[model samples]
Target chain A: MNKGVAVTGIGVISAIGNNTGENYRSLISGKHGISSPEILETIHKNLPVGEIKISNESLAEDLKLPKNHSFTRAALLGAFAVKEAVTQSSLKIDNETGFISGTSVGGMDTTETYFKDFTQGKTENSRYVRAQHPGFTTEKIAEHFGITGFVSTISTACSSGANAIMLGARMIKAGKLKRVIVGGTDCLTKFTLNGFNSLMILSDEQCKPFDENRNGLNLGEGAAYLVLEAEEELKGKPVLGIISGYGNANDAFHQTASSENGEGAFLAMQKALKIAGISSESIDYINTHGTATRNNDSAETEALKRIFSKNLPDVSSTKSFTGHTLAAAGALEAVYSLLSLQNEQVFPNLNFSYPMKTSGFMPVTKLKEKPINYVLSNSFGFGGNCTSLIFSKNGG
Target chain B: MEVKIYINGIGSISAQSGDLFSGDSARIYQENIFQAISPNYREFIKPMALRRMSKATKMGITSAKIALKEAETEVPDAIITGTGEGCKKDTEKFLENLLDQNEKLLTPTSFIQSTHNTIGGQIALNLSCKNYNVTYTQNSVSLETALLDAQMQFDEDPEIYSILVGGVDEISEKITSFRKLDGQLKSKSIKNLDLLKEDSTGTITSEGAHFFALSKEKKQNTYAEFQTLFIKNTIQPENINEEIEAFLKQNNLDSEVIDVVILGNNGDNRYDHYYKNLQQNLLKNTMQLTYKHLVGDFDTASGYAIYLAANILKSGKIPSVLKLNDIDSKTPKNILIYNQYLGRDHSLILLSAV
Candidate 1:
């Protein structure tokens, strides 16, 4: 097998915790961040969500942003997470260092607040007008880090973060960049919350992944990032994990739902395994997309069975702790996968009491220690976007 | 060995009709913000689906179908799209309703289609091509990023023989109008043809979609060979020429070998200097051309520039409306496309006659 792309550092901020350490501690402690919304001003207060308690003003203050700074909530959280990753990697930003961020709503929060103002010819929030585009949010974070080369943004719904990481690995393999920061960031917004509620997919209780009685998902807000470097650029740097394989495929099935067979998820997993030059048996654990929505859980389970058959590895959905963070789900789970590799432990899938009826598959409901080498993380989203990433303990 | 990429087919829906570059007279708009000339989307989309699709989605799907049909490919190996402010109409509808209705009794139709990847995903669903799909939304460099990804796909997967790539953006009612408050559009009304003449603060803004069918294999109808692409998030105006020179030199070429330079000049006095620096200095001898004046300016307007470059290289004809200088090229062999938005997301795409 070929040596994989090296992951030097990782950072995350979610409902469970604010940083990597806090998130990890919460993950192993079975702490769920789901609750009624407090920070987001929405009428659906009874609906449980994974809302980060920090306010936007407080976030901007922590980042030392100026009064006139036009950072959206996503940008603010993205910068918060990116700062930690950059610090941990001790990376020196340069012209060859690229930044690829995945975000779905982007600055919709800002847009929602300022739309009426702009229509009334108010220019106070005019700076945020451009933030409506996902790339504008990316540019704000890139500027914060002084990364001038090859900055871009991906917006593939919930799969955005996974796609960003995949593109970074592919770019490194293609000799396009010496180093890159890849991940996703998304904050709760009335737009997304109401949208999911309109679909009747937002659960009023904590989501139970892979459970027969699971109702739906609890929306979450957070950001996570990984610092990926070319092998030659590492220069004795400590490697946290290696992104050995990645794949993306379209279901061409439906807009917001997966097929009964999870064909897209299957193709993505197969392709990722092929890229890793490994077989299904080599995977030690699976971090499923497991959004807890009836269709998603069953479809993902079917896809998993198609790949591993009776020899399924230890699988769990960390979303039980962080809620469904949309664009940030993939990168957030990726960080959990790296943590699993580093600790040789599988984080439990919380709130799951009964096994899914159709597949009758059981997930590790409690933290389990294992001799894990390869961790595969799945992220599926709207527009039939499905992606799978394999992180190896040792560079393969 | 590296595989060669060819631009075999192109489809576009913009403010000007398809005949704009085909020797037909161009339509001049006097408004600051204009809309694209839409096709009979019924010809491409079914009534049920069309009812749900926003203008951006309809334009994206139709243009993609036109491109795929022209390339004579039933299904592409991959579908990649780049959109700026994707499905804004839908996004606005959802947000407006959420605000007005206080998040009560909302529908998911508009919200489901607001995603930036909606276009790419719809194209995949239409063709039932469960192949690689993705979307980029990095503004002016958005389309260039897609092109770069397409180039890499050919190298990453041997089975990916053909990929459909495009850039799309559409005007929204309140969102597009917000540009006026932020100075993204001119404060005064002006004719589209006279956009370049006025020493203005902002250029006229419009929306369009341009799709290209890129394949690894050369065909009899190949328009041009995709040569090289370079993107930088930021660069000082003074350093732009050096960046361009270095980029061209890395590809074993320089200013002399370039026969035509398609510049993205949107008549913004503040940022047009980035283009003017090259027009006056390094590329003075080259036959310079521009297209934003005709199509208006948007994040993906460069798609029209690429369309122009590929057509000119294939037909060996230069449309007079795009000419920016008196210099002429007997047979344009190499064409360069340079674009940026508000002095950021700078990109360079080089195309050569095969």
Candidate 2:
């Protein structure tokens, strides 16, 4: 039962890149994707975001969807990413194959745009009426691949992607599924832009995750997915990495703010390590949930200190490059974690000059090549949802 | 090492009151859209905290508390919730204000509470249970997804004994009305009790929250045994009989052994045939029951069916209002529930008397 779930392939489309190869290139090259909104029609032009430059029309056209299609931005991005993963893995879509997607806003972009028109009695875009549900986005991607089994969507805010991956792994482990496409997708929308803006956490510049001088986070839009298959299903397929363990916990502290002690993060990480049947010392790299917000960074640092008291693993926040892609953050980071393990290198945490004074823990500021075996990725979100996943190089 | 899971307790806040399950006459609503009969939230939650919550959050928390209290469990090992259009009232409010104010001068209160996981997170906060918590938002199968996760949790961890799981969905001003524009709701005004009687294109819409406290160890208050459940994204109408047969066969049970079959027939003529096909063929001889007629249709409307199934198994009483056929059972042993919405997200759940 402890046999690891094999990650056969990974796909991602973030602000920095449109595919896994491009994302890896941007990550190691120290290129950040944070920029002022270009395609997203948000009034917060001053706010920086990891906005994908591709427009919805082009994405639909590229996907070969009809003009009357109800593909929302999130659905479009999700399909765009899933197609690559399915192709890379050479996985056959069948009744046994399942699809689980994590999304926060889901199709909110389409809803926010067409809401007024619908209320004013417009029916031209009524196809998007049910698009607000996160499952709609997932089903769109599922429909594209003709997958008709065990489709579900998780919406635990920012940690959604990690939770989705975790659920997929658990399902495979439980023998409920043999192969499943699992990940998360979200796109920039006026609703989320203004919502985060209302929280007063929108950083006007590139996000500086875990940096002492970090002001806030830059919201990003993207989608990422991993093809997880059981050992029996992988006859000759190349394994990207192995999802050895995963854990989910709630802070139960506050609705929005994390606990000061990072209790949830600590428990989640500890649980992941226990599930992976390894000690904390075995982890070679840590992909932090470091959203660069004051509360999150400090709490996560505290959690890290508790877990790795003496020798902290080479830690970095890839969100610095992708600018906290919300629901897609964990899947994007999962792909990055696989990249780190495959290349035997750790991606740098961009824009980190100094650590917080309270917790003077400095993150890896430059790309470092090393013998990486185990990678632990953290993803925490609103509603105090915290998830941690352990990826093993040797299938554990 | 398989552990038996039992439904220790159930709490529901739906269109009809609790008395309906106790053989009271059903409340008739002549409208296509209805809301849950809210309980006194002050009894379950502090009034100060209740003021800021949306109906979905209030119902979820209160119902969860009810289930936990009934189970005599202080804190569960995990909490999982499935919701469709979570906190839509708050989401709509935040979106409308954001648009109305033209991205100017907006508060974060509504936005903060609008998240899909707010109910699960809030239940955790209220209980101070820092254990595993998650939320699923998969349309009609949301509750089934949570149940599937809980089932997996039991298989993975021996430490997890009790889990609080639920399905919730609420209506909003702009968002719920959008269903009418999209033909997801009946165009004509229909009575709630007459939901299944009318030949309609869309089912009546409503909001509800149902919570179940599941435990590995059965207690005196245990309702029934949660045998198993299956969820599939899509299936052909013609293949449903075979699907049910396959599921039953997988569990070492067949139609003859089934006592009561709870169907999710919401009166949408286009989709009702799926249930009609099953009713005439596979489950024709079985005692048929339905609950969406009593509680208006929503994504998690099947939660009511589960709640009803548990209660029926425990008390051995088949509420007359839910009977789809005159087939009677003095003490039903097995209950199988099959539900779907708009011809997608089909689910099958099996429960048996303890």
Candidate 3:
């Protein structure tokens, strides 16, 4: 059986920064991207969000597409990220390259805009009729890169992107595809803005992860992708990091809330550590999915306590910087984790003032330079979907 | 390297009524376009939790519970699901509120439940099973994709004892209207039993949830063994026979050895030709049967066909209502299911009686 999958290339677009370099620079500099919504036309303007400064029109222009193209903001961001990853990998688009993308909102941006118009007998924008479907968005990305083999989309809420990467690794291990590009993308929309506001989870101030004053998560928009290749395909390509282990588990607790004990997160971390064939102490850092919400931080803290009895590694939530990018959170954090491994540095959980009274866990408050070997990234989404991914400096 | 994955238990909540394991006899709607089967979810879910769940979540959880109960397993190794338009009811609710409220004071319950993975996540939460979770949303091939993932898990990890896999799809008024506007749904309603006979332009749309407990270890209740599955984004009508032959060959089986063939023949005249081609050339002499007529057509409707094939293999009895032709067989063993939507997302599933 294959030992490990090589991560050859990476791409990202988040509130902290657009490209990988900008994101990394912002991470160590402790720059927070959370702000009031300016681009998204939502009544929840006071609510904090990691809104991208660029407009959809400008994103399309950057991609050099026709003016009347039906590319949704989600598609535009996804294509941009995938283009970077593919270019960096130096891989040709052919039948051998597999495209696996994850998204929760798909084309909801376009669908929400045209929902009423379409019903009013307006036939002007029928091109987006199928955009609401998740598969349509994935197909757009696949077609953009001229990829024709084994394309699929996963829609597991926030954990979608991490699951996509896990599936790509399994496919490579199965010898199904020689090269695979896996990641996730999502764009801010009034649909999600109002959705989170309705749930009363949108924080009014900058999110304070793992802090006693934490309120809730701040929604964000962006896309991130990674190109993973089989061992033989690696040849002389510089490997960024090795995807050594991954796991998924369901809490089956509630539709929108996590359980008190963080059962799903605990199981997912346990399974991932088992798959990586390493002890908990081997993990030097953890990029938490800490959305700074009451339910998520507590549950995740409990999960960590259960998984690593006494020796929990340095943990921090980068969502403090980029906000919670829904489907792209896992991928964005993955890129950050690889960066941490390469630079042997840990990004601080900005805006944290005090530790939570219940969990009594404190995240890395300031940027710390340390020799890091393995990093565990966690992402949990609605419907109790929890996923954990472990990246190692060397092939496990 | 070759490991056998068996369907130990099956559960479904579709237009046709009945709990998991009970044949589709308690309630079967005769209308072409029927609503989903409503279950007393209180038994499986709490009232507070039930209040927030959409039709997709309720159906998925109830069916998953039934499947797990039948298999007598408390926790599964993984939870996987597939849906085309997931949580449509919530999607519509949230969208309506978004436009009506003009993006003000909208609650997150509907929006949170509206994601495609909500059902899978809910099932995982309900079972407290945290092994490996994934969801697929590949149009008509959604369910097949979930099945393929389960099969891969079984082949790769022998420790994975049981995996809960299912597909769900629901219809909402706005999306349904849009589909009708797009000429996707049938224009005129016909009897559900007579869907195939109607030479219409579109197929009847419906919703359902089908869950199966798949494992590497076979038991007495094991329904059938999943052999292989293949999905193609686009396939020409002329290439249908060649594709089937090649797939069967890869599995070391030939067309003549197939005992039964389940076809997805929704009343859509444009795309029904794909099934007709297979019926006429590839498996013309094989025992042909169909189920979309019984339980309208949807993205994951082929899941119903898999349920029926599994039961048929287990009982060795063919229901008269599902028979498409009179090529009778004393004992049906190897079964192949072919399904596609709008001439795209073609999928082939092979199963054998355990």
Q: Top lDDT: which candidate number?
A: 1
User: How good is the docking of model 2, as DockQ?
Assistant: 0.88
lDDT of 3 by residue, A1-396 (tens): 125689999999999888999999999898888888898887667888998899888988888888888888888999989888888889866667888888998999999888998788576787787788888888888877877667788999999899899999988988878999999999998888778878888789988899998999899999999999988888888999999888888787777888999998998998888888888999999999999999899999999999998898999999999999999899999999999999999999988988888777989989999999899999998878889999988544
* Model 3: how far residue B146 lies from native, Å: 1.6
For candidate 3, list the clashing residue pairs, or say none.
A198-B106, A198-B107, A198-B108, A199-B108, A251-B125, A252-B124, A252-B125, A252-B126, A253-B125
Q: Model 2, which residues run further than 4 Å from truth?
A: none
For model 1, the interface Cα RMSD in angstroms equals 0.6
In candidate 1, stretches whose alpha carbon ends up further than 4 angstroms from where it belongs are none
- Between prediction 2 and prediction 3, the one with superior lDDT is 2
lDDT of 2 by residue, B8-96 (tens): 98889999886765668998988888889999999998888999999999999999999999999999999999998898999999999
What is the TM-score of candidate 3?
Answer: 0.93
Shift in Å, residue A229, candidate 3: 1.5
- How is the predicted docking of candidate 2 categorized under the CAPRI scheme? high
**Recovered share of real interface contacts in candidate 1:** 0.91
